[model samples]
Target: MKAGREELMEIIDLWGYSEDAQARIREILESEDVPPPHLFRYYGDRPGKVEQAERLFERTIGTPHALAVNSGTSALMAAIAAAGIGPGDEVLVPGYTFFASASVVVASRAIPVIVEVDETLNMDPEDMARRITPQTRAAVIVHMKGNPADMDPLMRVAADHDLTVIEDVAQACGGSYHGKRLGTIGDFGCFSFDFYKIAQSGEGGFVATADDYLYMRAQSWHDTAACWRPDRYAEERREGELFCGENYRMSEMQGAVALAQIRKLDGYIGALRANKKRIRDQIEERDGLALRRQPDPEGDASTSLVMFADSRELAEEMMAAMRERGVGVGGRFDQTVRDWHVYSYWEHILEQKTVTDEGCPFTCPYYEGQLPDYGPEMCPNTLDLLSRSMHMGISDTWSPEECDRIAEAINSAVSEVLG
Candidate 1:
């Protein structure tokens, strides 16, 4: 007998792995010939491996420098610190993003000014322009869920205001914007390799930049109290002094896994894109369910596929139904930083200091006063779309058949729940 819809759904996990992955992982684990060391030891003396890793990164990104760090958050923090953005400085970040985007700014001792997002769920350049003032030192454009932010206009605006642009390319490892890789476009680009990411190393990240000074600073920050000497990092070390930051370096084991994953990035990206297209084609006809639109077709490269709901109620209902049928879905950035209670405590600190609207430094009420009245109208498109959006993971492991099954199940569930 044929299985029921629920049965089929239960059998189809979104992230299906190839047999080769298991073999590769096992081969690495069983090897005993001077077994690969963890990152701590690997980075201690195996300078040649680090050089190989850097070469791989350089070839893949075509960037002048790539500083592998512990996490995407560290990359952002180090990059912000290296760029000279500090206390009293305001960095514009999109409201609809992972908390890290804003957290990094706060961690850097700078204030995070929340900006609205456009249809693509990226930072809205118009809102960004309105929020920018004399104190706005930089902007972190988070390519939310692997979709590239509108970089062309964003870059133009940054140039006009003399502001630095940092591309939070953590979610967009293989993504590009206007023929340029996502991380390479901005003043500095950050990438993550957490297990859930497209190009994962179990836990790691990297920062890419063309600026010699910023690159050198990032290296020092990754290695506590360590300065890059020509004899030490020769062809690898780009620039910077001995101002040691925190230790956020990635290990060689993680780097090895990352190197393996990087080799398969293009193929993985192709499979994800193809699967996304199939799923979207099947579900776009359903009512009360909408696919997230990409501004640039070529720029959306990661595997975390997002969709829009007609309303918050509908979105919650759809998510419940999908989960009931064994399909996983997630919400977009619902807890905005401005609404988080932690910011309130920080408010007191800003209150003790002088805040001037002349430049409109930060988003805190103490700085901006009562916060800009952000409602549905201020960002009609994002507000409307977010109320009902949902996301699904598109892993390299899923087959075309599995993707089709997922799409059909989602469509049927939406029809049954909403209709």
Candidate 2:
């Protein structure tokens, strides 16, 4: 009989493995040279923890299917491949996201057409609609900074253009739009559990979709060689399923910890929301500045509060003053030379660099129409908004006093800068 994961309950290591590893360091030399055969275990489930986590996402996030991968980038690449998007296909990626968002599209041999974002610092539906062309196959709508994009109009535009919608929910895992979860609303929803994300398992992510065919394709893409998963191995695949792919599967440990983190997702979001509202309420209506315009404020994960100063010089001065007052959470903005989050710093993409000298993706014959006009000035709106923005990171563990102090610092900085 195939062993079940439940069997491990019998020998449950009550003392967690992490602490035991440190405690037993020197004892390894004295341990049994020929260990007893009784220690052998077989988990009938394919990497028990990963599958368990996948199931959790289905139940918690409302996605019909999910595939665990090593990183959010891999999750996106797998999703792109699963959607049958490749050379000659152009995907719309917002200008303000981390470079990886656009790099992944390049990795998939698809052109990433940069789109402008509004003060919300997310993809603008109107701009997205304007960029579509015969070769435009999809849009990777990134819910950046833990807030959902304007999904209602975006989805309508996508539907009108017949564009595949891939929701880059890496930063907005628990965030929602209207009544649906961020990832659940798109054709494929990708999430990240990196150390920096809302709820993390160090470094992990997953791909989610409602379509069975896309789910299978994602599975096949992540596990290219068709390795033995108790589900199947070397079985006849449906047409358009088998192809050259990469290994991006999540480990048992990552899946276990990721599942635990996601289980507490709501608790984290709630604390952050409360903390954010406390600070925003005090300063949002202030003159000489405006808070970020969120389409669904209630559904926001509330990771950060962005305030746009009336001028770029004033915004910088406010940041400096806030730092003096010790409320220095402002970040991931500006045109720093090496900031990976800034698109203008992406020399590799701008220069069209690739693994081989051929620049295969860029030079591919399948590419259609005139290539997009790429330059530092391509996203004027993104640059302007970011320059005038003061980003304050919202924490889940702040005391009431901390919230008030932070709010006071912000108010002081605004007054000092704009007075």
Candidate 3:
């Protein structure tokens, strides 16, 4: 018997494995001599599956260095450490992004200054500029939902402030910005290959950079102060001598899966982009409904289809209408729905303290006087725009019939709301 719609919806891991990916995993499992070489990434190391995956990642992202780590959050943490962001340092992050964008700053012993987002759901460069204080050291530009942020102006702002920019391309694996790949455009580009991301590795991520010093710094963080190149090794070899580091290394098994996934990434991104464009072209200009304004020099990886309505009321109406037709429409303001990606939905970030007891990051005796409190009022624009936004998932696996049904549902929902 065929499965019910509700029953099918319960199965969340839609990340189907490619035949190539399956074969690679099988080989790893079946081989007797498949022992990982230099799993710790020591110098003069023989290249294994992990190193091979790193090389492929570097070539794919057009970066000089790529260090695979345990998770996207680990990639961000390593990037933070590489940039030398520490106590009293402030990193600007969009208030509309995933929790890791802000939490990673905390983990780095730095403060995350929440900044407002524009209609594009990306960090507003103007607001980011306004939030800058003497303590501001870096900015993390998230390419939310595989849509590239406007890097031109954002880069200019960061340059003016002498702030290091890190591109959070977790959702934008195969995406680019103005012909340049998303992650390579910044000081450090971080990517996630978690099961849900564009490139699935079960659980994995990497940091990409063009600077040798930063690459070495990241390597230290990835393997507990172990040097990537032998020359950087400390003569005394004291703990935390080169720098305070942690264990965030990716395993050879994970690397094998990621290497296979990388080969199929471009085709998947291309298909999803085409499907998104087809749907957007059909419904974007309809009255009371429109696609969110994509940044100039847009790179559509088509991770999800986001639509904004004239107001919150219209957005809610359209959401209900779409759901009745079997389309799972997600709204930014729906707090009860726990999985919404909007920052307002992440109460943990606002409620929890960055550092326990001492308030080492926020209240640490580093910056000028007292730090400004982070709360809802800090990003009014983000709060407002998100109230009227809704989105639906897009995937390479979607069939033409599925696309048609979605388009029809969107059209009908708009008509129902307008009528």
Candidate 4:
């Protein structure tokens, strides 16, 4: 005999809210024998799960267009490809972001000029504008660790420089700035639904834009074989303007999970904010200790709480004391494993390590602008800010009492160490 609906609901309940994602997968498995969206039978004539996901995500993001891709890295690559940025072009990237942000520029055969970050740990508009040259084409503004970058100034600079703005919202999926969402403010918004992001589809991403022409280019880039065409078998393959590209299309399985996870994004961000506020509100602020400033506190994703010490030694001491008290804080710099978030540790770009011997992008004759002098200490401001910072992540699943305990532990650490 088959289990009843109530029994299935109960089973889903045992797994908690995230079970919706699992239930979605199970629902698809039980009802349909459908293969991936790109399968011959499942063409683009009718919307598949991936298409549905794109629509759902578009509505959630309030963007005019959104194309679901395989990964966040692919989303960045697709955005660059769509913009037609190539060798000799320079894309300004922050010094504190994931290496992929800069590496994507190199992948496009373009130069990635590293910009210094201030105390905010996001890109500095001043540094960005200072780095621009004749060949500068674009800027990848990263929303680091679920915090939106200061977009108003950055956008102004981009406008003045005629640079394409690609907002990397991988860490700030549900986050917003002022009244607008993080991804909607820029020329193109990229998001990651990886295992560690606010929303998770295991490994999935989306490229968003308000431009129709660029949307078509992004679509073509994600599925160059024409599988994403309005009619899969159309006689003119390029839709008159599209061209041959790569395959970064999201499958039905990933879409199913992505839809479910996104459905819970608001709740996730809400709980995270509430939990973070509870702990933060109780902490006392005084001399030699300051919380990271948020331009729009209400819109912040609130994934991690950062405390800046007056000195690196004090920061290290605070982290050690906090850890001993079970507050669970860690320092920002880690040279041993070489944290990918820190720009100084990136040996690939600093050393100009290309895939082949010829060093096409680095040595390409098309690059007319003078190459930048990269080094471990290129961005001293980035290293200085990171050195005196202690990071502690806030959990959406924490209880009110748990938040109180954390606050108490933090207070204790500050008194013993910073005092």
Top candidate (TM-score): 4
Could you say which candidate leads in lDDT?
A: 4
Name the lDDT value of residue 363 in candidate 3.
Answer: 66
Window of ten residues with lowest summed lDDT in model 1: 340-349
Span of ten consecutive residues with least summed lDDT in model 3: 4-13
- The clash tally of candidate 4 reads 0
Sort by TM-score, best first. Answer: 4, 2, 3, 1
Whole-model lDDT per candidate = 0.73, 0.82, 0.80, 0.86
Enumerate residue pairs that collide in model 1: 16-397, 39-251, 39-252, 309-388
Q: Model 4's lDDT to the true fold?
A: 0.86
lDDT of 3 by residue, 1-419 (tens): 43333222232224465667655655565554333334344452476677888998888878899999989999999999988898878889998878888888887778778888887788898998989998899999999987888888899999999999999999889899888898998899999989889997899999999988888778877887565545666463443337668988887667878999988888888899878877776774666777877774247678888888888888998999999998888887764666435666555556545447766676667766346575656677887788889988886777777888788889988898897
Candidate 4 lDDT, 339-398, residue by residue in tens:
889988888899999988889688989999888898989889888899899999989999
Residue 351 alpha-carbon offset, candidate 2, angstroms: 1.5
In the range 12-99, model 2's lDDT, one tens digit per residue, is: 3432455456346425634534322221112432447778888888888888898888899998999899999998889999998888
* Candidate 3 Cα misplacement greater than 4 A, ranges: 1-46, 225-228, 231-241, 296-298, 337-340, 345-349, 352-355
Candidate 1, residue 411: the lDDT equals 84
From the highest lDDT down, the ranking of the candidates is 4, 2, 3, 1
- Candidate 1 regions exceeding 4 Å error are 1-47, 231-240, 285-288, 320-326, 333-384, 415-419
Evaluate model 2: give its TM-score.
Answer: 0.89
